[model samples]
Target: MTLSVRSRPSALAMVSALVLSLAACGGTTKESVRTQAPAPAASGAASASANPDAPIKEGLKLAFLPKQINNPYETIVDEAGIEAAKEFKAEAKEVGPSDASASSQVSYINTLAQQGQDAILIAANDPNAVCGPLRQARSKGIKVVAYDSDTSKDCRDIFINQASSEDVGRSQVRLLSELIGGEGEIAILSATANATNQNTWIEFMQDELKKPEHAKMKLVKIAYGDDDDQKSFQQTQGLLQAYPNLKGIISPTTVGVSAAARYISGSKYKGKVTLTGLGTPNQMRKFVKDGTVSKFALWNPKDLGYLASYAAAALVSGQISGGEGEKFTAGKLGERTIGAGGEIILGPPFTFDKSNIDEYDF
Candidate 1:
């Protein structure tokens, strides 16, 4: 569920004031938007007064840092984001750690804040590890956006999450339960141990699985792949080897889900064991076609990226803040509202199957 913060259109007046100030200045230049500290004039000259509330223009050197540098998911998301951000005349650049690490991210965050980025969007590798540096950057007048995974509450201006925690969590277990006949040993192939979304969904799934409504279903184990394909493959192999009677495996990460399909498709467990999780339609299309993967769920990865970019642009344009019920346009997704806890849910989980598999390329 998403919430929209009730905000009057007063901020639009702020935008108008910014434009009016530029009009009063005869010709608007970069200097017109910059807030300056009052300094004494050299020699025997009079000091100039300051205009501290001048609003900056929208052409910002905005950047996004993913958890891992070379992943297809992040790349796809960033590509969509770039296209959306271009409409607002903002530059969107993608940067991140070579590996998913808090220290590397901290270094880059400090560097960007020091070099003067207007805003930075990042998916935290560790929940609270980089909050100190992010908050420090915000204190320096550089904005911060927490996407994918959020940081500390005070560290980010807003968080753009794909969907609510319970929606993703309950849907995955329900999908797995249906394919496995609602009663069989199932293991979860989740992201890193520190991933908040993965953990949140897993917890909800566990709770949902015990509701007597799904009494026959049983959760056996949970494995961490750190979102590595090879590691996920090994974990799936281990799960199969460890439990000869295992009926299903749910992989929450895109890498983990894809790897599980590849493994089961080649292994002796093909057709007998079900795999369900978050995966791209393009990547898992073949598996779904051949029945290796009966069903898996995901939001449009491109749209998620697209929405994040628009949200960044809105924040920089002063369209919205960390308030509740603030609605913004996200192009093809139409109006998106900032829900409770400051999350903007694009929509609910979408399940893919043979009937609709060919309809979507992403």
Candidate 2:
């Protein structure tokens, strides 16, 4: 997580990257920033190709939805699915709102159901709020899978998690605890307070903090930035000003973590402070490159969405259901199942640093 992220302000690099990617992709930057409506029923635009060697069944119309459209994490995951679809011969298209909002996603969910999609995979905007509609979609024979963030278990047939939430939290706590030498003050710059995965990870971190070795890493403040870089940057500054001796910061939000790292890197506290959290490799690379951040964590979102799409396609093709013991192939991703508490881990998180940063472009 030793990523040397920067800011004139912070983490706008992601937005900059988005702008550049969209421009290269042949769309106006403004339109590309939002997850537009699904392209007129696939339009037969070579969206469904043949997969001679793939394990997928043909003629599937699958929908992939993250909390928001056009986001770096969502964009990568969507692109990965596009590549997988070319190989698997399934009809995969991503759709979601311009911003991460429960109301917006709820409306989009309604549209997907109306579109008669074979399966729908989602990173829900709100857990409890979206459950009812998801359950209703299921009653209509649409396969429902939760990707990055989840809807409640009862509302979802399966949760395609990027990594174990507990694992993510524990990784951060262990790394941060080590950075602080097991003792000192710390804080959390979380995403929206209600985000299920973030909340679960933070709860796990709280429980971990009770461990004897972590007794010195006093978690001083907890703040929310709504995943906005500006807000996160402001909160980071606030934390520094409010808690002058704050030893470290664990920002479980991708945006929050990067913002904190950027602030810590350029501020007078550069070497004296430590920061870590869930962040993208591309977003965190420069930060790590400069030693602004020691280490941070996140399951690869591209892989997360790739697997989620495959799982949804499997359900559409009748390969498997969320039965007590059912295994399915996510193509190159290997086999996975609904484990205890209905969990589905994509894989373990990779810790980013100098040695491997260059290998990853996103």
Candidate 3:
């Protein structure tokens, strides 16, 4: 199946536009300025001499370190990355902690670094928790690419983001609003509090809720499930118990969303509480058919992984440095550009409902 891909405005451009709009409205508050600033640029370690004409190196070793080894969403991503590795004849492997925790990835990163891998791809569980090890990896001339969840800019060479962070975050709120008929107490069931991508999206979700169009929606709570199945289910139960009047829930993590749906599906909140967020089609199809969830959004994990693998290959092959305006070809996905902060966005997310859920299997 073909998917539509679109480029997003650069972070600097988006921040500049937002600052100008805020200034015009006489609301250029310090808080707004701080919140609107773009993240620091990627470390200069990736600025090695570029050779855009160089071919992907053969027999190079690449390792994918996801937040959790058992996460189905991340499994789809890493598997695709591995497939992309085969296209260039590179050896690729996936390794990570079973539990998604802040420091769980550091040891794995240290191990990869010691093993002298050419490239290390990771979906950071916490932005700062993995920084020291990532820095050490880069110091050893190993390329680092962060995907799905990002690490701090200085920690990685480039980030393969699934979509625009703001769009992903704001779109969740928009979908949840539509599902609940625009208003009532809604809580967010998120992944670990330290998850970089989750927090970034949640910030945008909060910002979206402030718009006049979403004024009626009151965010009652933000609950953390730590991305565990049982924990997310219990969190869902706690949310309903704490706020009996809750009308909707937005769960932007695959694990959290599916668990939340399972909980709501068997509880009294089934038809009453609207549920929406990012989820895999296979995991959410049953919920949509049973009327437990109305809509949700996500980019294809396979494409995300494929792009990240190719990006890592390009970096390792010195095809392009992780600098703004650099470009490289991702096997089947075509050309991808490196944007500000060394981010490569896959595309805008697609919303799935009963109508199109069947079209996707991952």
Over 1-362, each residue of candidate 2 has an lDDT whose tens digit, in order, gives 11233433233344323211110011111111212232211111222322223456676667777766756666777767656766678777778877665566887777777666677788777798887677667766777888778888777767777777777788789988888888888999987777788888889899999998787778888898767777889999999999989888888777788888888888898888888887887889889989988777665566666777777776656555555455677776676665654456776666666665565556
Which wins on TM-score, candidate 1 or candidate 3?
Answer: 3
Best by lDDT: 3
Sort every candidate by TM-score, greatest first: 3, 1, 2
Give Cα distance to truth, residue 181, candidate 3, Å: 1.6
lDDT of 3 by residue, 1-362 (tens): 22222233353243223211110001111111111222234643345467788999998788999999999889888998988899999888899999998999999998887777888899999999999988877876788999999999988889998888988888888888888788999999999999999999999999999999999999999999998999999999999999999999999999999999999999999899998888988889999999999888877787888899999999888887798878899886778888888998887777778766665566
For candidate 1, lDDT tens digit of each residue in 1-362? 11111333453243223211110001112232223221111112211221122233467667878888777777777777777777777777777776765566888787776666667788787778888788777766666777777776667877878767788889888888888878988889987888767887889989998888688777889998887778889999999999888999989888889989999999889988989999887889899998899788877666677778877776665666656666666665666666655677665767778766665565
What's each prediction's TM-score? Answer: 0.83, 0.82, 0.88
TM-score of 2: 0.82
Candidate number achieving the greatest TM-score relative to the actual structure: 3
Alpha carbon lDDT of each predicted model: 0.72, 0.70, 0.83
Q: Candidate 1: misplaced stretches above 4 Å? A: 1-56
* lDDT, residue 80, model 2: 77
User: What is residue 243's positional error in candidate 3, in angstroms?
Assistant: 0.4
